[model samples]
Target: MLRQLRGWSYMYEKIFDGIREQAHVRDELRMGLVCDACDLGPCTFDGSTSRVPCGITPDEMAMKNLAEKIAEGLGEYKTHKRHITMVYDMESLLEAATRMVDVSRSYSDEIDKLLSPYRTVRTVPFGLGGLRPEAVNICAVSSPRGIHDLIEFTRTPEAAENIECAGAHGVNIVSLGYPGAELAYQRGIPCIGNYLVLDNALATGCIDAIHTFGSERASLEEALKHFASRKGPQCELPEPKMHTTGATLDVTAINRAYERGNIEGVVVLFGAASPTCSWHMEGLVTDLVEHGYLVLVTGAHMYEGSTDAMNAPGVVHIGFCEIGKMHGKGFAPTPFVLVPGWKNAKILTSTLALVHHGYPVITGVRIPLTPSIEEKLAEKGCITELNGERVVERISELQSHREG
Candidate 1:
């Protein structure tokens, strides 16, 4: 009852337009970032009929050239490992795909080292004074509403406390599949599979060795059958409730969280899959946009990799729908965070997915398209937002040296 009352108070004090008025953020949230200075950049385009392709620097051009060479070396490594010496009849496709595959292998090798405590010296921090030194254990379950997942993990606050006591930094609950990617994005945690059909090989890091005995391969059907057989007819089990509406559930969860006054920020997860799901997700995005909520969509995931292997039409349709809505609303580009299981994490693919859809991702590296809308604001050296009639952040220069 207290929780519910608190939610009501939050709704009144923070969820309404008045909440925006009271906006305040901590100074620790800001960080000095190493500015990127890549040479040969890609062709630049504005939304209209303008194209500028020759602004790339010599260093950037040299880096791109070197990257292409490294790709060739990595392709040779893959050819040796896979025993496909004469498989490539054309050098062009091999050049492109091989470089990506090679870079991927090198990156994976690095992550494996980073995951180990002994390799601490080899680790480099990439964001905000380097990656925050934290390993977050996210206990998540997937059900119809997504709340079941959070509630299950936190059965009691004490139970949640136990995980924290065990050294978990933050908590993440993903009841629905769509939110998994976004939760992983905002929380900066890897998806450990609460309840959906996550790729078994990817989930377990058996992608390169699925045929080997060390990795177990099981289908959704096999899993259900195993569960049912364990029951042995003692009690009849009902059919699981199949959710045909992810978008609807997403909208419902957002509204509920807002009512609870727990939403400080939002990461929108909408894939261009299933026309029905896409339609609903797009609808939610539109609603959130009008309300000035920060929403990001991952439309390209709907059409990439294994995702594209299945629902091509659905993915394209969903991407187009999201694009249309964003264009119409003049909504800013927000990135779709990709939370594929570790070692098999498709961070680059996911980044490319959103870039393909023409939006900045929320949780990962911003795809270099337009200068980030945030960057646009930063051009003035500082920008301010109206919060309870107080200018925020912008006055820090003066406030830091206040006199009596």
Candidate 2:
């Protein structure tokens, strides 16, 4: 059986002020402020004495081997695309965290204390728009004005030059865009650059950090863990439900199940690809988030296959694009939370980085392509949403979403 684990989970206190805050009227923008340290999962201390024998062991040799394999595969299949690709996007997750930290930086004493631990947060602005028609704007902004500032601000040549510096220095650069994986394969850089919805994105080592920005949060399992970590024992959050599928969960069904006494918490079992579903289960995420359901979004190709290279020379970089888009529109998640997957090691590292850096993430794997491969992915806890004819035209429909 494949092993599984939760990365980071956060709990939020539903805090709303005044009659306007509680009103269900559509005009109210201040949804509510739910704050609490969600519980994060158990981390493998780089090299621990009591190491578990996962697919990618916690040893540097295993990690290096995996990285070498990925690098070698890219070299062996040097099929290049002519398009200028945008790699990763910071999205709403990063932005919200920055906002949280910024708020914490200014107000709360507890947050001020935590700020020292999160000094690695990126302050500079960056993007990949021009040249690539399909380029995605992958950036992070803390305040409401951050995104606005980024879009309106003029590019200083000095900052533009920093791309070279960032790349050269191996600063875990994230690329946000659709063609990110192809771009990474062509560039030979570990595609830890952008966030995509497919499983291959993870297994291929395309994104280093899978940014879960915007609103709809992780399952109760992850959120509770998140709460425990930052808040200590004073907070009692929900327990994590290890589902058969390797997807992040939502609380809707679990809440219902609780009412029916189906079980204590929710347990989700899922696979990634759907013959009926289209293009990497994009809006399906909305369902997962809205329904309060836990899902293993995909399979090994994305999550387990991703950080399998944890012991590589340097940390890998992953990118997320849409999370930022959703949050920038002024919609706050009803219950904000995040969690990382346990299928791979780098996920833990990335999750820790985001949490430490103030970014919240929902744990999940990317969708794989081949059926047999997807079957293997199922073993790793991925959830399958659509199948048959519906699955065939998924990507084409996905393109429509991009266009529409």
Candidate 3:
């Protein structure tokens, strides 16, 4: 599995590694102070300097930097959400609502209630011109309901896991964001995340078809058209679904996962990958799930045998953005593990957010940290390694703390 993924991920791994190396070098060169008021000189953080010229402490600077990264992640998700809502039509919306009713009715009354307004509406205008070519395809990938329905709808033998369809020809599945990528993968379509990773995936000479959601459709289509005209190399389609492996968890499913005695706790995993890392991550998740931990995964790791992991009976796949939504709805107080990928500033900031919110998190990958940052996180009782005994002990401590 690692070998195959390595082949697919080579281009992406190089790109990510290069960026991280460049950033690390830049950080090393920085004096680490930038005045908020004037974007002033990078003042040294040596012992001689108690504060930057702006009177900001090292702690303050760290917090500000973290805040900026968090804000950037928030902004990206907001934009994706906006695109999804803006492009969905009433008819497609109704179909999605109906499918939700069909597949999840037994488990969720909230979905029914939430979608009630859309049920009575009819004939929604095609709001975007790009949607006309294959409006259902666009809608199916964009909206939440559409995404859910598409996965359920595609889970048939006739559709197969990797069927060769006219529509899929010369196209690569450039899945936009978290849940979308997870859904596409379950349907036997290979997917890459949005942003820089998405660009690298397209450049790999493997994807001719662009299976994406939200505003990404336009850009991907433009790229695909260019590739098609030039007779570029095409990637082989992923194998069809031989079995139902992954289960998508919404708010209700998440709540139920907790309610059931089967789930000991929940752990959220995040990262992009090299094939080796992907393999190690999967092994770690499998071990955790076997021990009765309900693992909730997002980001690039979602494509790493996530569905197969669900066969362990304790793994629930979710979108990266959905983690905060779940956490916001009184879920933060729950003791869970946050295993972040190494070296990514975005993941680090997210880990910081989880730690700040008082969650017991254990890092799955080694965090690139300064001594100060490491000391601070340690003082807060955040685990920076994937030691099983340590994680269990920390979780017990957090649980006791909450109970008290």
Candidate closest to the true structure, highest lDDT: 3
Off by over 4 Å in 1: 1-229, 232-345, 352-358, 364-404
**Residue-level lDDT tens digits of model 1 in 95-118:** 333334445345434432333232
Query: What lDDT does candidate 2 reach at residue 182?
Result: 19
TM-score of 1: 0.22
lDDT (10s digit) by residue, model 3, range 36-123: 3221333445555565534567767666666765765785575444433354343332232232222222323343333333332111
Q: TM-scores, in order shown?
A: 0.22, 0.20, 0.47
* For model 1, the run of ten residues with the poorest summed lDDT: 304-313
The C-alpha local distance difference test score for the whole of candidate 1 amounts to 0.30
lDDT tens readout by residue for model 2, 1-404: 12222222111223334444646442211221111111121223332233422222335434554565576467444532321122122233222224333332243233223322322212111122111111111222122223222322213454344423333212222223322321222221122222222233333222222323332122212322322333222222223111111111223443454456443222111212222223344344333323333222212112211211211111112222112211222211121212222323323333323333322232343332367755543333223433323322332333243346
Alpha-carbon shift of residue 52 in model 2 (angstroms): 41
Q: What is the TM-score (0 to 1) of candidate 2?
A: 0.20
Number of clashing pairs per prediction, in order: 12, 79, 9
